[model samples]
Target: MTRAYLAFTETGLALAKRLAVALPGSVARCGRDGVSLAEWASAQFVHSDALIFVGAAGLAVRAIAPHCKSKTTDPAVVVVDECGRFAVPILSGHLGGANDLARAIAAVCGAVPVITTATDAHGIFAVDEWAKHQNCMVLEPERIKLVSGKLLAGQPVYYRADFPVMGTVPAGLFLADTPEKADFALTLCPTGQALHLVPRIGVLGIGCKRGTSAETLEAAFAAFCTRYGFAAQAVTAAASIDLKQNEPGLLAFCQAHGWPVRFYSAAQLRSVPGQFTPSPFVQSVTGVDNVCERAAVLDADGSLFYPKFACSGVTLALACRPFAPDWRWQNA
Candidate 1:
């Protein structure tokens, strides 16, 4: 669990104590009231995901904002009254903020929670959480900010493949067709279909030996991700498993990646029209199919451009696309 810090007036210290008991992570309280604001802020800066202020909103904001990381990927900030009856999400929900924590506090204190972020209210795809689950790195975190800005202002967000996002479009901005133009574009796993906007595809592919151990597979996959600059969460789906479902390695791979193993049966592969290639070993071992050939064949809506590298044992494919403007996470 991430560490959380609470700096409150004497009246609010009891609330902080309650929070420390309920929230499993480490918690701290501010010292003497007369201490310098800088001293207070700096004291809790280490490894704390949130800075909770129990009183004096203006002072709390000013004192911590300057100390926060410039881009603010960590250490969210919040403010509440001494009664603990009103909780406000001041910063950093996606990077670990007081949004949920504040809400938890509010539930305990019966306070009103102020959460204005669209994703949380609408219950859509939280790109950051997905990234966290997949262990994928975000190339451009600010793009999500721009995307949310447009959404909050009632702008249209276009998804090439209807990728689920946090908020709904505000009517006027949603463009249904390619208008020979668009305000912004989002691609979902590159279908090669004629899209009005630029393509942004997320891909997941996998390969594996007949009987690789689950532990070996997981360690190898993690190492593979670290070695190649890629986020595990960006994996949209598992691309192969038909011949290897019985293999513990393949099943473990699917579970680890949080994807349903999409197997292409031999008959299904035969139906998919492609410049299909077959390997002797693949045909001999699996008896019914080829892995890459089947994957390419199955992806009828989009063309599969095979990279020149061969992943031995078990192969798990993931999107290589760096995150774009729409794919971002922010504090709620």
Candidate 2:
């Protein structure tokens, strides 16, 4: 991760240099240029992984006030005084990993790290933090407060995971056998309510006509997810033949959803071993009998959840990779 160190004084600059030993790809900047701190913070928020302010806590707060967005997307922010008395995480404690970073800074600079997140303070089950640790895509991010609130209030929250749980389940979260018995879910498929965590273990394979419209392709994508009980937001990679790599319509569709398309040559698709519903017409054109089915399962070690299906001038297939969640192992 990258960090931008903004030091206000020469003493703070020296501390910034010492703190730089912890972060590899970090840049330290001084305030001698008379640049606006607000504008500086705005620019750093877009690309910086974390922002370290070596100044007063109120100064850091005022500089980042307008640039502060959601805790989910914002970069980790920490403030440390020039004397290195305390390292406090001012924003994005859990999901953005500011709390852990503050402790690391404190260890390096010999400062006290102050953590104030309710879930961490009480040692409860934080669904959002666990989801990020598991590399799962959080659906209904707005509803994260509901799960956290329930846990903080000492209320029982039931959850269902389609995959295997490898560690001891955290307190306040019960593992339910079915979705009907749960308050939230941990799966890529559709669940009952708003709180659900989708693991990024799904592979989406696509095959479409040469000149299909982006609108048609997008509509087909939404419908495909709805009809097959899958969440469109859970797709990690979009696979297709090499010929469609430059296809304008396909590129636009994936780009709109922030999904990168993975292109495989016809030979690569053909080399994939498994049962496939071959199409002679497709083979004559692209040198592969099955593009969608072959592309989906080739990179994933799991089976194809859906066979080749055609709709809206676009052919699609869905496949899943094996996912295992361990409560003890966190990316933090």
Candidate 3:
């Protein structure tokens, strides 16, 4: 991950330099640079993956206070004293990986790592960390505490996965075959008030009529997800036939969702082996019997879970890549 080190003193700058060496792709900047701390931090907060402040924790906190946004999007913030005696992660500890970054920084400088997150402090299972490591996206981030709090309080946190998960289950977590008995659920179609997690394995394949408006495409896509009980966040990317590569509406819809679109040729779609819902009309125009389903399977390199559903001049399909959950935790 890209990181930047900010130092306010000679001692800190020296430590920053050493820390930067231990972590590659990191640059050390000292107060000698004409930029004010706030200005420098504002720019780096948006650009850097992690920000290491070689100064007091208070100074680091104050500097990053204004720029702090959602924990999901903010850069990991770590602080180390000029003496290099302690490394503290004061912000975005779990989802933003500040806790992990603090440990790394402390190890590099022989400093004590101060991690204060309740789950980490108690040595209990952290659902968010586990989901991140397993390449799963949390849908209701606000409800994360609902699950983690129960686990930390020695309460059971039940869960159920829509997909297959291998490996020994962690303590304090029970897998229920039913969603109603679970505190959290791993699924695209979530029920009840349980915290919902979607594995980042779905690929969406789309086909739209020529000159279809972006609004039309978006509404169709939303309806498709609602109809099939799939979370839009589960879809990591999109695919389509090459004939629609320049289709402005299709491209805009994917762009707005931050999903990159991969265009496959008609011949390529035909080569994808599957019993697709043949479409004579689609074949007449796009030279393929199916566009959405075939492209989805090809892009995912996995089985198509949802066949094509057509509506309002748009077609949508969903394919999912393989996923296997484990107990190990790492900042992904």
lDDT of 2 by residue, 192-300 (tens): 7748888887788999999887899988888888788888767887899999988999998888878778999999999988899899999999999999999999866
| Positional deviation of residue 316's Cα in model 1 after best superposition, in angstroms | 8.5
For candidate 3, lDDT tens digit of each residue in 76-159?
888899999999998888877889988988888899999999988888888888777778888888989998888888888899
| Superposition error at 125 for model 2 (Å) | 1.8
Runs in model 3 deviating more than 4 A are: 26-30, 330-332
| Candidate 2: regions farther than 4 A off | 329-332
Which window of 10 residues has the lowest lDDT sum in candidate 2?
A: 23-32
Comparing candidate 1 with candidate 2, which one achieves the higher lDDT?
A: 2
- Candidate 1, residue 86: Cα displacement in angstroms equals 2.0
Question: What is the alpha-carbon lDDT for the whole of candidate 2?
Answer: 0.84
TM-score of every candidate relative to the true structure? 0.48, 0.91, 0.93
Error of 1 at 219 (Å): 20
Please give the distance, in angstroms, between residue 164's alpha carbon in candidate 3 and its true position after superposition.
2.6
TM-score of 1: 0.48
Error of 1 at 88 (Å): 2.2
Candidate 1 on 1-332: residue-level lDDT in tens? 45454555667766766766776444445565465667767766655666777776887888776667743365767777878778887777654645666777687778898886676676554444434333344445655555455555665555332334445443434544662334333433222222212222335555567678878667766765665544454455556647755877768766876666667666665665655455677667766445653553354245554431244565443433333333333334
Question: In terms of lDDT, which candidate is stronger, 1 or 3?
Answer: 3
| Clashes (N, CA, C under 3 Å) per candidate | 24, 0, 0
TM-score winner: 3
